[model samples]
Target: MTEIFVKSLPLKDVISNLAEAFDTVYFNRCQEYQINIPEKYGTGFIRGINFDNGFGLLEYSCSFKESLSIHFSVNNIHPLKFIYCSEGTVKHRFEETNKLQTIDQFQNVIVASTSKNGHILLFPRNQKIQLNSLEISRKDFKKKIDCDLNHVNVNLRKLFRDLNARSLFFYHGNYSIGMSNCIDSLKVNGLDGFTRRLFLEGKSNEILSIQIEDFEDDQKEEPKRRILRKADMIQIQKAASLLKQELHAPLTIKDLAKKVGTNPTKLQEGFRFTFGLTVNNYLNKIRLDYARDQLMLGELNISEISGNIGISNKSYFSRLFKAAYNINPKDFSKKIKRNSSQQH
Candidate 1:
């Protein structure tokens, strides 16, 4: 790891300073100034673009080779930063406050200028480090939008009205798996050049939108239907675990509920609320994922594997398998067999 000192005396300096300091930065068009840094602080990549609208997009997946501490004296004026960590944890403390706030795995932080001038962000080594951050220049962002940004989050509305204030406003919450998946897809895409610029811009906007939705969802006064008490939900979740471990057992909804010391209604509702799937559908997904592994192993026919996962009707199982993965189980099995034969 590098022992480093970085001071974005004003928030706007962070990006420009980084581009000039690191040689690993690469981008589509030299005109776009869109750069990707592969070995900043350690082994990982930071890819982003400096859009024409005076905003920037950034995604980070860096594992510090050793402990790295950042002392940032950031006096950000009108720039707003939205950061989400899908894998590791980041710790920070503002210059004015002793209270340390941590953005942990699957959590996010959205900060805009409020009444503070400086803050500190610390990244721990060997942590699962994955982050998506957006730095939007207030004046430029306003020029790009004609309507109020109220649809995203109420805090955004507050920030818009009080642009002159010099404070720090932030929101912290759990990020949806859907949001994590979206960022992961961006990390793995093969697109490049001008087309990559288009993709990056679209994804940057989407990530911002998703983070705003996270805050709005947090403020929901009305809870979703089928919500279960936390304690009882834990028991029901344990039952789900049991069902997964005993997939070959022909456990009905009623049986599973009884085994887990809850009613069928609670069982079904807890599964839906916790995992966003009905009990049966959740079971099917688990089974199908397992079946795919078996298909790749080339050890059993579709019928045998289907029976192993508690699906008996072979034809119906094939339908479910195809529906789940968009490939017939038989075809998937054959593909694996062919690949294996070639390997031998």
Candidate 2:
């Protein structure tokens, strides 16, 4: 494995140090710096930008020809980092320790080294990898915020106030959908100059907010369940769209799970997380909602509406509709017709 040592503070200088190690030049525009990996070592580039608020963003989209480790060995207190892996896998550990933690695709880690211990990031050889690191200098961030820390969560408050880097902190988990969307937006919209800087700054803050919220949610005392990855969320969304489009052919949980590339248990958990309902309950709600709209159109009778939504038993469908909307399907349809007649 090859190793590159980066001994710099702030983001711009970090890019410069990396460029020196890679034996390549770097580009700078509007305080953002970018450097491409030399052909001998790898392909792709690493971009970084530092905001006036002490927040910085470092994006890595590259692959190395051999296993590589970038060691951050700054002499002063290092910035707290929220590192996210969007593709492939990366390993991380404090420079002072041998234990390493692997961050896979769709996963993230919050890391702060004690004092100047620094951090080391390892990338496997010949694998496409994409990662984003949100770096925050606590001292600068505190001054920028210019607010009391009493309102913050206990763990986070301590983290924010530890400007001297008195203790170490680390957390790992699957990134939430909000964070996934924020990360995706960073790669879109061809904005440049001040507009691009402002856009990135805004997104940086948004991603921080989401990270804090997700950390808090993870701390809650909930039942043990599988953590949902971004891929799982996408599958869950596909299942929902399928359910809506095929209202006349409702699928069983196992079938729906198979179609969506997830198991029944994960499907149920994802539905509950995304929609606050189980899979069957969500499907039922969708069917009833669709039936309500059809009834309002006055083009289908109760029996036809029930059949259209894959409910063979009209009486059972009526019970479900009444439970959901507090009115029997027949009565709701009659009310719609009566209101139409009155209008005419």
Candidate 3:
């Protein structure tokens, strides 16, 4: 196992310290600091950006050649962290605790060590892990957003107000789909320079809000109305698989819900929550994506392609295809043919 110990404050120094450990240098652009894993170590990258508001983001998307553990032992108050495991498993524990927590896919943990206590993160070798850490310096964050914590949940409000790190805090929950989407947006956005920084800051604030809300919902006495729980996520995945398997003969929302052992409303809610699309729209997307592939093959007419995907109306299919791809099916097919002939 490879172990890297860090005792740095603020984020830039942390990234620099990590880079030094990896035998590589970190680059900074528009306040974003990033480092690629040295070839001798593994593959992929670790990047982070800190905002002026004391909230910062650190992302790890890498596969190490060997097991690794990073120990953060800053001798002062550490930042509160909202860590999400988007892809592989990650094990975490407080520096002073024996109990270890494993964060699996789609799971998140909110952690804050007691004053001067530290945190340890373990990454298994050969696993392509994608993790994000949202860090907040409680003292700085409180100064920026210091207001009546009346609207915040009692526990979280207290956590936010613990600027001195008077108590340790840890909570684990499945992150909301909204938070997932927001994080994705942060990674894939095209903005650059000052604009990118502003966009990231805005999204960071949005994500923090979502985290607080998810924690509050998880704390609810009766969570029957929670549509994004682990059980619901499983049902949603089942529903999606069903949709894809029966794309040519899509089921009604009620029938699909029945197959998934959920009500139509909850099923729809699940779809919206997990996929950001209603059932019908998601089905349409499936159909359209399939149609685009068939069109690219240049073997089937637009009507046949549409029919094969369960769209009966030729004109309606054309409209949906146009709306989705910004070009009519016929034109898309012709363009494909033209390109094929030109290559020949």
Q: Output the lDDT of residue 220, model 1.
A: 62
- Model 2 regions more than 4 Å off: 223-312, 315-344
The digit string of per-residue lDDT tens for model 2 on 23-123 reads 99999989999999999999999999999868899999999999999998988999999999999999999977888999999999999999889999999
Error of 1 at 332 (Å): 27
Instruction: Give all candidates' CA lDDT scores.
Output: 0.68, 0.88, 0.87
Q: Pick the candidate with the highest lDDT.
A: 2
Clashing pairs in 3: none
**Comparing candidate 2 with candidate 3, which one achieves the higher TM-score?**
2
Model 1 segments beyond 4 Å from truth? 1-16, 19-41, 71-78, 150-153, 225-239, 244-277, 280-344
What's the residue-level lDDT of 193 in candidate 1? 79
219: Cα error in model 2, Å: 0.4
Clashes of each: 7, 0, 0
Ranking by lDDT: 2, 3, 1
**Whose lDDT is higher: candidate 1's or candidate 3's?**
3
**Strongest candidate by TM-score:** 2
Error of 3 at 254 (Å): 12
Worst 10 residues of 3 by lDDT: 222-231
- Model 2 residue 94 CA deviation in Å: 0.1
